[model samples]
Target: MRALLLTAVAVAVALPVIPAQTWSTTACGPAAVSVGDYRQYEGTGSGTTPFSFTVTVTTAPGCTATGSVAYATEHISTGPADITATSGTLTWTDSTDAKLVVVGVVRDGTPEPEEAFSLRLHTPQNLVITRDRGRGQIIDDDLPPVETGLDGGKICWRYESSAVEVGVHTNTPARAPITVHYRTVHTGSNPPGYYPVKDGIITIPTGSTRGTATIRLKTEPNLPDEQFYVEIFSPSAGTLGLSRVPITVKSKR
Candidate 1:
């Protein structure tokens, strides 16, 4: 007889969260069946790791019972029909015994909110099922979609300063390393004296939300204020939210 032994990490051994749903009971022929408390796990996009559920049968004196239970996904995907098990066996000896059902949570690239599934007991042989349903919750670990753009629509540059710092920001933290490409385009005539067209890259490291790009400027005295456009484009990771920003370079007095 292959008996299932409770492991140190078994959900039955650990204190479990009480399920919010109410349970119904039926008279056992001699023993009663019940599922352990609810279980939860993070939803990683892997098939190897699975969620474990414990189904238990409490036996009365000299009461040996047999039964079957089924697993169904209420808001999760487990298989073709979203069903994990159609007829899983549950057996009870004179003492209490438990069976564990391991089921996988399907993965997807699309980010989703927390979801759940359920297991129910049925078709018992010489036993009653009291607390039939067990629930499993999946905490979503997928990163949400993010957008990146310039932190400000306009920046002011003093004629005497050699460089101006521009901020690049994302709506949310980067899931991976992100590179934002920006360049200064001539909106009007370039400022007098060795004005170099600025092409810069701002790198936002993984888990960071912001980066800075430096735009070097060269200005001469007694010249009209000039304007230029900073074009935000070609982000390596996320969609571009704001594309164009204006910068004003004031000539020295």
Candidate 2:
């Protein structure tokens, strides 16, 4: 009986081991999607210029993602005057992951305050949006120089020793020294000679909004109420306002 039991155990051990039926399932589905952030962009110079911004869509590894995304401008806030409009669209594909949109900016030939607007992403087909909105800034690069008539529009000089101040104004602060070329025109009063016009250029220090040019009148006894002109011209930057200035020298009684 013992020998028979041992033989049975040996037979059972010798039998080949059968592996459990293994089942594997393959994963099939759409890829995970996400959108990148769009930052601010700026444009310079005058006239119509093309400006563009980009939007990015990221897909999970090994993802066979396919869908379409749309972009448009929203919450557009223009300055006091209408400057320009923003417009564009973006689409997603397996081959391309990023897309760019171009917008038009109308740069008027005048100095104005900064303007701003925003862009929005919506109607995403199969992608997740990490950031849906981005802010855009349109910087005003138009800097113009305007000449303000003499401080008081006119200055009366009683004597040659008396001097009058003429001013030039700018719409924006000067980034660098601004020089204005000027000359004197004797419109009235002869003889005794006109006041010596020494400096032809008025240098406006950096960051200053205004600069002045001085003209001294010549003291004459019987000169028919002399009048002289201080004409401003050729500014380093921007346009000139009231280029010509008039000064009256009241004749001595």
Candidate 3:
């Protein structure tokens, strides 16, 4: 997630009458030396490596002087390693820059009014959604009923709603909400167990996969399918369209 704004403002001279040149450098937060593990400036302004700065200059009708200002860069790791059994992935990052300005009135007389602005940058977002490919078939389409289930590794859905890390002009899209639906099919009398009825998959085609309604349900044989129509809608776009999966059953007696 990234955002940028070029704010144009009238340079206030701090109500002080100046005719020539003026220069001042105000430092901020020691100006972060590095980002997570990546250095920014390589110690260009700060003492440590990767140090960077934001320079601002204000000149009247005629002024000659250099401006020196400092800013900080902080990172809030995305897709942290602590989130437990979360439905989807979440990310956090601090990408805001500090705005420091040095003005020379560039006019008759007006107070600089302790001008201060905030500059923030965004870090890259990391979201992951996963689902297994259709391995063969659950029913097998054979006789004797399979009565078995397949494993669909970690199914996930990920998205971001904010863009503070990706920086400006970044195609890195934020995560979005996702929902799932499923169709269940079971034969024979029945059995008891935590069957692989409904689950979510993270990996998908593209776009935010959110649940708009319920998952669509249908039976192979319409007659016995019974209420065979369940509606499922995803608010966001994703790879998986169904959520619940049912295995077929067979009885000899």
Best by lDDT: 1
Residue 225: error of model 1 in Å? Answer: 0.8
Candidate 3 C-alpha lDDT tens digits along 29-125:
2122111111110101112111122322223333322322222222222112111111121122322332221111111111112111122222212
Model 3 residue 122 distance off true place after TM-score fit, in angstroms: 10
Error of 1 at 124 (Å): 58
Ranking by TM-score: 1, 2, 3
CA lDDT, every prediction?
Answer: 0.62, 0.58, 0.22
- In model 3, the Cα lDDT at residue 97 comes to 31
lDDT tens readout by residue for model 2, 1-253:
4555434343344768899999765443443333333322122334444445667665554554567666776546664234345554455566435666655556454676656656677777766666776655555545343333334356464654566677777666665555677778866445533565744888777677788887765555555566677887656544566787677667666
Candidate 2 stretches greater than 4 Å from native: 1-46, 79-89, 144-253
lDDT: worst 10-residue window of model 3: 161-170
Give the total clashing residue pairs for model 2: 1
Stronger candidate by lDDT (1 vs 3): 1
Candidate 3 vs. truth: CA RMSD? 28.5
Hey, what RMSD does candidate 1 come out at? 22.7
Candidate 1: worst-modelled 10 consecutive residues by lDDT? 40-49
Best by the TM-score measure: 1
True-vs-predicted CA distance for residue 70, candidate 3, Å = 17
TM-scores for all candidates: the values are: 0.42, 0.40, 0.18
Clash count, one per candidate: 1, 1, 53
